[model samples]
Target: MSDRNGNPQDPDNGPESPHRLIEARLQKMAELGESVELYPYGFDRSHTSEQMRADEKSLTEAETKVRYPGRIMAKRGTGKTLFVPVQDERGTVQAYFRKDDLGDEAFHRVQKLMDIGDWVGVEGKLFRTRTGELSIHVEDFTFLSKAIRPLPEKYHDMSLENRCRRRYLDLAMNQESRERFRRRSEIIAEIRAFFAEEEFLEVETPVLQSLYGGATARPFKTHHNALDMTLYLRIADELYLKRLIVGGLEKVYEIAKDFRNEGMDRTHNPEFTMLECYAAYWDYHDMMDLMERLMRRLARGISADGKLKYGEVELDFSQPFGRIRFMDALQDKTGRDLMAADDEEVAAVAREHGITLKKGMGRDKILDELFSELVEPGLVQPTFVMDHPKELSPLAKAHRETEGLVERFEMFVAGFELSNSFSELNDPREQRERFVAQKALLEAGDEEAQQLDEDFLQAMEQGMPPTGGMGIGIDRLVMLLVDSNNIRDVLLFPHMRPEQS
Candidate 1:
């Protein structure tokens, strides 16, 4: 007779079970408050359970008898016998149970209570089922945890809205979501390795600053009681990282959590991860080369090829990234050179394009608005739009060839800006002037203008080496690499409005 409790058969008080048919027999459990408890307290970790179930075909003869513990993903067939698909984190395997083997009472238990999604451990011999599926034939079994709620039916309708809202359910059922995350991990690993090989010292910067002066973006402010002052969450790590360069760290990088008080869209997030790096003695040109190589490495690992197919666009990372001048791109699209265009002419062009160029809107802001509305959406390939007007790029050094433009380049892929690099300004005087100009702009109602970071200026006074700094939106890059159009798909948990209480 089969021992349900794995104990000697009793006659008089033999299994004081309910009078009703034992349609389902729970296996002897090692968990606390469970049947014939063998463990001391919590039994979350199954001691005898195999670390990872090996494929039967790949396993040695001795390994074929391995017992595995996992959740039941699916169940089919019943009556005198049952077939259940058990899934551990690594993979899934089928488990078979029979009425004759489990005996009368045990067989009934299997029928009623052995529901899908319950965690169970089975000590079984590996063999091929008559259906040609590799399966485990139970010698003995144990209950791990009983899942109270039933999982969604595998054949149930799955909608995009439902998938995003109930991500846990989607994760349990959708293989695509699982694989995307797996690739995300690999991509991060490859990026870290690449940075390490380049001798870039990864450093952490302050998240909450007394004065937020990094990038030109609105800041989320909060109060600190002990200090009795308002603190602003960092929008970028540029200012702080550059300060480190002044303090003698030649090459430094920060994989920072930057918070932007901005609109949430398909490509924008309020809080995001960015890989910002600064290298001494490197210019924007050199930075672009490094960036291309890093991107190629990431694409190679993500797809195991130098190309990634993203939304009808096959982006080939192997080929040399194309370079285009910002003004030339403008001239190409607008039939007028930016340098030759007066304020009136620029405003006329803006009006023609239905772009609202406000009163006292400087040439730079007009150009920026025009670029966003017209030029940006057109850049679908891996193209670098270089030599931005000086007013548009505050931190970048003045261009060598142009009179009023900066040596900066923004790389776009699949119509999204992936990376922004610049020949960083090393002149303290010029840098301070730029900050003063920005402060004036801020005072004149341009809240998104860069702030005057006195500490950063002081660092510049101490002499920072000529540097090339770059910031890459990791989420955007991941989206491109994974061929995901929606930014939320790349992010594990995106910000959502609180539900009504």
Candidate 2:
């Protein structure tokens, strides 16, 4: 979030100056040391602002005493009394403090040094003000903590960069930021609940791997000091989860952090969360069905009616998701069957479409490019872009009906690839052949090509069953549910460029 309102200010400040404001607060803290502990160890409290608000009716009727601790967000009036809004995590409560209630020294101490953003514990009886608003008539108060610098004046007006960078300020000042992240947590929980209902066991996988070979993405490389061998941060959890399926864990899912050494954008992040699952005896069709059901569950969990408006587009989860074959969609867009075309023909289509082909860029990659460039953007509604070419999905089983295609489908929503699934290839010999093809691509200078993992091949050779695997970009899913525009908005602390000193 950008600080569009310029800099925050202190109560007595004229124009903004950070050094002056901080130094002034520091001096005040030193003075307050004589009357109270500026950095006190703790403040005993009976209720949060939310709890206080909830019990207000009974408490006010009984004239009950309550202790509440929270950060001061707003301060009003002067002279012998003041009304301040003390905010805790859930909400805020109005606190009324007067010289008559606390006597001369305590009230004088508060008036002299207490500032907005300071945390205080107050003992008070609940009552309504002249305007009939619920308020705490303070009997006593204690200083808990002090904020040396003022908070941003207009937090919502902050730029995206600033809000993400200074998430602490954003959470403190803006209710929307707090609620958005809380919604992210709820969405994740709902996903887990949906899988649990389907009896998929939640599992853990390694973050670092001996060899990475799930998705077509470069990995963040690292060295193991003890073993003294090169290890790569996992780019996806597909391989390990598949191994679990081979070991007879028929249904499994992992919500994992994956590192991909790639470009960063609104949809892409170097480090992101992924939900990868594999099921034995299941095919891509079963996985697609599961995705649709899960989407409906997640939509209702985040919003009522299972419907949402993201920017100008309204996404309705109440209806069935649309379906289109990968090749069919591409052919419709370009008025030609580029899928049946030869390697050179595909390359020509790519160039004609203004997609830059790298050194090892093959026909499958070119086809994917064409789809992404031409057909993907129009997938505003939920859709399954199904039956991709065999070369494009090295780990997917060959399609039962189609000659050159694999049983693969990509779920696209709001023009973004939400998930990818495949009827996983189980024949060890065919798997080896696919690995060889990928190896050839790797040798031809494709940094994003999947490497042949001998151990993974060995597992497949050990009579692995026909399995279905799917991976959901959890961050992207959260973005759609929460209506977040950037991937960074969902991530607590997304990867960023180092500050230039």
Best by TM-score: 2
How do the residues 298-337 of candidate 2 rate in per-residue lDDT, one tens digit apiece?
8887678989888789998879899999999999988888
List candidate 1 stretches off by more than 4 Å.
1-54, 58-63, 104-110, 157-162
Cα RMSD of all models vs. native, in order, equals: 8.4, 3.7
- lDDT by residue for model 1 over 458-482, one digit each (tens)? 9899999999999999889889988
Please give each candidate's TM-score.
0.87, 0.93
Judged by whole-model lDDT over C-alpha atoms, candidate 1 comes out at 0.79
What is candidate 2's TM-score against the reference?
Answer: 0.93
